[model samples]
Target: MFHPQQEQGQPSCRQNTEETDTDSDESEYNKAPDAPLTPHNMQTMLRKATTDIKSHLASELDKRLSGIKEDIESLTSRTNHMEARIKELTTSSQAHSQDSTYLHAKIEAMEESLEDLNNRSQRNNIQIRGLPEAVTMEGLHNVLKGLFKSILPEASAQDLLLYRAHRALRPQGHNGPPAFLRN
Candidate 1:
């Protein structure tokens, strides 16, 4: 065959070039002929690399799973704490409600007792209206004593005793005279 590497007037030495290329290629492999790449070696390297990759992936997965587990445990603990707090608050609120109810009932009872005591204190007391402003305390007392004596002749002086006689604290109006209270 006509070769491109040959000079136009020179003959092609194809056989000699082929022999040189073969010798150089053999010299390179002759140095380590026992360690030549083969299917068995490639299969062993592939298996080792696959096992290493699997081990790495498993380790990463374990780390992530442990971290997730820790996070779940932390969340569970917080949830439990919150539940306990809610229960405590509920109990406290119930107790406070009971206390408020008790206080309200006691206050109402005290108010009723106060009203009853006021009515009882004023039951026997007398209010004399239309009394003239000119009536003195001593004069009103004497008039009441005489009136009581006339009304109850069998009563003793001690029974007709007047505790106090006084006029109303309000200013006298033009429509009516001042009133007196005798107790």
Candidate 2:
């Protein structure tokens, strides 16, 4: 039998009963007032909560891990640069050390050459001792000429050449005897 409300496009008593039954069934499964707390419902809720937490934790861990990976890469790059710099410095230091050694050897050779030259130049020089400090340059020249004539009487005046003659430098009252340098 068709009702008047059903003919006017409104819900009839049978449709209302079916709608209420569907709503009550849905509310039983998804927490509702007067719905009994069954183990199945609790398990379903716990599974959903765990799934959400797992997804959140996974996302957080991924973000943190990506950041850590970037930091590690940056540190690795810096370490590589530092290692390269250290290598460069070590190479430069080794080169400088070699140069320093070469220069030191060259300097020693030059010093020996200078000492040999000095010895050769001073070989012809002579030192005259026991000479009075008050002897003048003219007096020293005359005395040396007379002594050379006596020592080599056959030698001419040209062979007896006196380059320079000077008194030894010292205090007025020193313990040492007087001396003269003849060159």
Candidate 3:
């Protein structure tokens, strides 16, 4: 059953299919029956594609710009908060510094007053010896007042003020001297 078309030493099926495809392509290429494929039509399509691409890119750029603005705003607020905190810390330190200076001055004044008080208290105190220990211990305050009256005679025993009275320790390794009462 060899066909006549196959006997001609040609690519039988391929040649037939190529001829059919080429005939259909030639008919499809002349799609616009009334108008021709012109440069203006191509330019119009190119412009439309360019406009669509530009619009898409503009929207993407706007989205990125808004995100960047949000990030910048967040950073700005954080920076403002840090600055406020730093200012608060600086103010607190300044106040503390002033308080420290005032406290130091108060402490120095207190020290001076304490020293003056010690000197005045010492002035009112008396150390006496040669009195019999028994007689001194019986009523040391009365005995001292009487002795002061006998010695001074200008001030009364009632006028003397005795804030404190005590027996103080003697110097170390000096045991030969007679014991004395210190007030």
Candidate 4:
């Protein structure tokens, strides 16, 4: 079959002619005008372009590094603040524990003192039993006066006897004779 370009009378070697034309055009354009090309000027322009690109890259890197450094410093400051707060809380907790221990000791001492007072009060309270049916207030007074003389010598025999009779008659659940009858 006859190709379209061949039928239209176009060159069969058109691709080769186009390549040659492009090469020749580029070579003509690269030829220096009146001034001869110098290695020094080419080197200077290359150095300037490289320096500008490097400077821009360096500035961008410096900005990123500065932002990172600020973030690191912020993190460090926050860590320091947290450590200080932890120390303060630890100290406060220790002080509170010490205070609680001291309060506990004081409460224990107070309880012991109250227990002693209660024991002494119980000792002072007398409970007399197995008395004869004919036991008189006078006889009871004589006996208590002799017994309590060492602790409460200032108290009268009659008062001691009356208090004892009242307590004996009202012993817990048993309500004994009236006040006048006991007397």
lDDT of 3 by residue, 1-183 (tens): 222346566555445444555435334444654555443334334555787899999999999999999999999999999999999999999999999999999999999999999999788567875555455354877777767776788885567766655554543333333443334
Inter-residue clash pairs, candidate 4: none
Model 3 alpha-carbon drift over 4 Å, by segment: 1-53, 126-164, 168-183
Q: 2 or 4, which is superior by lDDT?
A: 2
Highest-TM-score candidate? 2
Better of 1 and 3 by lDDT: 1
Question: What overall lDDT, based on C-alpha atoms, would model 4 receive against the true structure?
Answer: 0.63
Tens-place lDDT per residue, model 1, 107-173, is 9999999999999999989886666666677698887787678669999998998888778886665
lDDT of 2 by residue, 1-183 (tens): 333335566555456545555435445666664456543345445556787899999999999999999999999999999999999999999999999999999999999999999999889877765665566777988877876787699999998898887777855545444333343
* Order of models, best TM-score first: 2, 1, 3, 4
lDDT for each residue of candidate 4 in 50-83, tens digit (9 for 90 to 100): 8789999999999999999999999999999999
Tell me the deviation in Å of residue 156 in model 3: 12
> How far does residue 41 in candidate 3 sit from its true spot (Å)?
9.3
Error of 2 at 152 (Å): 5.1
Q: Residue-pair clashes per candidate, as listed?
A: 0, 0, 0, 0
Model 2 bad stretches (over 4 Å): 1-35, 136-155, 172-183
TM agreement with the true structure for every prediction: 0.51, 0.68, 0.47, 0.44
lDDT of each: 0.73, 0.73, 0.67, 0.63
